[model samples]
Target: MDARYAIEIDGLTKRYGSMTALDRVSFRVERGELFGLIGPDGAGKTTLFRLLTTLMNPDEGTAAVDGLDCVASYRQIRSRVGYMPGRFSLYADLSVEENLAFFAALFGVRVADNYDLIAPIYRQIEPFRTRRAGKLSGGMKQKLALCCALIHRPSVLFLDEPTTGVDAVSRSEFWDMLAELKAKEISILVSTPYMDEADRCDRIALINEGHLLAVDSPRGIVSAYGERIYTLSGGDMYALLLAARRLPHVRRCCPFGAAHHLSVDADFDAAACRRQLADEGFADVALQPAESGIEDVFIKLMNHE
Candidate 1:
C-alpha cells in the first residue's frame, strides 16, 4: 500500500501563562502506521493530543488530521478521529453495553454498526456486558474505553498514555491489541512514558520539557548513541552514584535496574575506573560492555539539555 500521510503537525506551540507546553513541535504519521510519542510526564504529549483532536486551540502553528484543519474543521475531524484521553472518563454508573451505546449514539451511529471495528477488544469484556464500568479491572476498563472510542470506525485514533498505572500483563496485552488494530489499516498515534514501548512504533519522537529531542525509527535513535555505557554495582550505592558523576572520564551516570549506568568519555580507561572503585572499598566490582537502549539515550539527551 502507498504510504499516505494521515496527520501533520507543524511548528505547534501552546502555553499556559509563562510555561510553554509544546515548543515548535512538528511531526507526521503515515496512514495505517503505529506511531508513538515517547516521553515522561509533563512532556507536552497530552497537550499535543488535545490540539490534533481539536479539544484546545494552539497558540501558534497549524495541525491537520486526515486533511482537515484542527481549528476550522473540528466537527469533521471529531467524527473521523477516535480519542482516548490519558485518564478514564467513562460513566462510572453505566454498564459496559450502555457506555458503548451512549458513545455510538453521540456519533449518530449504532453500537452494532461498527461491531467489526471493536469486536476484537469488546468481546473480551462482553462477558461483563452488564457490569458497571467503575467495577471493572484496569485492563478491562482500557479495553472498554478503546471499544467506545472506535465504535464510530474513526479513520485516526489518538491514545494518550493508555497503559499507565496498569499491570505489566495488561500492558503487554494492550500492545498486542494495538498490533492487531494496525493490521486493519487504522492510523494510530499513542503517547507513553515507557521508553521500552518506543521500539514497537514505526517511528518515535522523543520529547523533553516541551522540546523535541529526536525523531526516527527505534534503531535509528539507538544508532545515534555513540557513547560507551557501563553498569556499576557495589557497596555504598549512593556514594558510587555520586562519585561516578564527579569522575572526569564519566560523561554521565544515572540509576538503572538496581545499578547506576555510566556513559563514560570514549577515551576513558575502563580498567582505571575499576581500580579506583576498588580502592574506594567497593567489593565484587563488575564492569562490562553494554548496549544502549532508548531510556539510556533519553537520559543522555536530558543531561545534555
Candidate 2:
C-alpha cells in the first residue's frame, strides 16, 4: 500500500495441483526502480509476473501495484502496467503498425498520444511498419513488442525474459532502450536466465525452484560469497572435475565455461591441490584464485537451498 513502492508482494504463493510454482515469494520494487528477477527456466519467474500483472490469481498472500491491490483493483492495474511475456504474443497476421495501433485502441488511447514515449524504440522498426509481425526477424519483433507495450504510457513495465532468443547485438540495444525508459521514471521488473544481465539492474532477486535465495545489488551478492573460489583447468576437464571433488579441502567444484570453479576452504593450499591432481595422473593441471561473480553466487545459493 506504500506509494513509494511501484510493486509490493508479501508471501505470494501459487500452485497447480501437486506442483507449487511459487512458494511464499516476497519482494518489493521501489518506484522508478529497475529491478531484475534472475533465475533459470521453471524457476517460477513467469508465474510471479502473471500474478503481479493480474493475469493469474495466487493461491495465497497478496500483491499491490502503485497502491492498488492486484486482485481487487485488477482492472485499474491492467491499465497502469505494461507486460511483455517471454514468448512473442503479438498478432502474427498484423503488420507492425497495426499491432501498435491495436494495443493503443485496446487501452482507449491513440498512438499519437504516447508518440514521445515510444518514439525511441518505434523509430527502429518504423521502416518495417508494413511488414507482418511474424515475417520480421527476432530482434525486430522484440522492438515492436516493446513499443506496443509502452504505447499506453504505463507506470510500470514487466518484461519476462525479453532478450531470450535475440542476438548479442539486439540484446545490447534492448538494454539500452530499457536504460532510457528507466531515466523517464518508469519502474521496470525484468526477469532473465542469463546471469551476466544481473549486473545491469539496480538490484536483483535471485530465485530458484520458486524460492527467493537472496535479494540485493549485484555486487552485494558477490561480496557475500563467503567461500574462497578458484579456477582449475587442464587437458582433461572431466577427469580434473572428478579429482577436484575428491579433494578433502574442496567443498564444491562445478564447470564454469572452460574451467571448473572450485570452492575450497580459506586455508586450502593451491600447491597441494596441484600436486594431488598430478599424482592422480592428470596433465596440464592449473589452479589460480578467481573473483566470485553473480553466477558463482547463484550456483552457491542453489546448492545451499
Candidate 3:
C-alpha cells in the first residue's frame, strides 16, 4: 500500500474463459494525476476498470486503490472510489435529482452533504433536475451520470468511456469538466476509445487486445513514433488508399480524414511518388510532411504487436 500513489497494479491479469482480457498489466498512478487508458473497442479498458473499482476480482496480480487492496479491501475501496461505468447504469425512470440522491443514499450520505463538491457540474442540469434520466438528451444524461458518480466525493474516480455517443460539443464540455475535477485533487482513471482524447490526460496507457503497449505523456508517445508521416490527398480517396499500399519504400498507410497518412523508408522519394501517381492516371496529387499524432502511434504499435 503506497499512499503516494492513488492506484497501483502489479502484474494484473484477467481472463474470460478462453480470452485473456489483461496480461501482466502494471502501472502506478500518482495522486491527483489524470491518467487515460486509450484504445479501441474490446481493447480491455472496461475490464481493467472493473478490477480496480472492486466490481470484479482479477484472476491474477495485485491491485490497490488509494492504498487499499482491491481484493482484501473491496468494501473500503467501493466506499472511497467513485465509478461511472461505460454504460449508463442509473435508474432511467428516476429524475436527475432522484438519481443523485439515490446514489448518495447508497453510500449513506445525503445529496446536500456534498452539494458544494458537485455544484460546479450539477448546476448545469439543475434546471432539469425533475426530468427523467431516460428522457433527457445524450449530453444531459451524461451530466447526470457524472454528478451521481461524484456525490460521494471519493478520493479516486473511474470514468469508463464518459464521452462515448455524445456530440462533439458535449465531448468537449465533458473533458472540460474532467479538467476542473482534476484541479480538485481527485485522482482520475478514465478510459476511452478515442485516440484524439489522449491529449487531455497528464499521461496515458495505450492498450490493445489485452496488452498494455505503451504508457507515457501524450507527447512522449508521439515523440517515440520515430517516423515522419506524409499526408497525401487527391481526387479519388479510395483509389489513393489502394495506390498508397503499392508505393515503394512505404511501410504503413492509413486513412486519416481526407488524406492518406503514410510512413516510408529513407529511399522513398516524394517527387517520385507524385510522378508515379500522375503516371497511374491520377491528377492533382499532393503529398505533404505531417507530424505523427497519437493515432499514428497506436497504429504503429498495433502493427508491431
- Best candidate according to TM-score: 3
TM for candidate 2 is: 0.96
| Candidate 1 positional error at 279, Å | 2.1
219 in model 3: Cα distance from truth in Å? 0.3
Q: Tally clashes: model 2.
A: 0
Segments of candidate 3 deviating more than 4 angstroms: none
Instruction: Give lDDT tens digits, candidate 1, residues 98-150.
Output: 99999999999998888998998988999999999999988889999999999
lDDT of 2 by residue, 1-305 (tens): 88789999999999999999999999999999999999999999999999999999999999999889999999999999999999999999999999999999999999999999999888889999999999998888999999988989999999999988677787777888999999999999999998888888999999999999998899888887646889999788887888899987888999999899988877788998788888889878779999888988888899982
lDDT of 1: 0.89
Looking at model 3, report the run of 10 residues with the lowest lDDT sum.
220-229
Identify the runs in model 2 with alpha carbons over 4 angstroms from their true place. Answer: none
Better of 1 and 3 by lDDT: 3
Quality of model 3 by C-alpha lDDT? 0.91
For model 2, what is the C-alpha lDDT against the true structure?
0.92
Candidate 1 TM-score to native: 0.94
The root-mean-square deviation over C-alpha atoms between each candidate and the true structure, in angstroms, is: 2.1, 1.4, 1.3
TM-score for candidate 3, residues paired by index: 0.96
lDDT of each: 0.89, 0.92, 0.91
lDDT of 2 at 229: 88
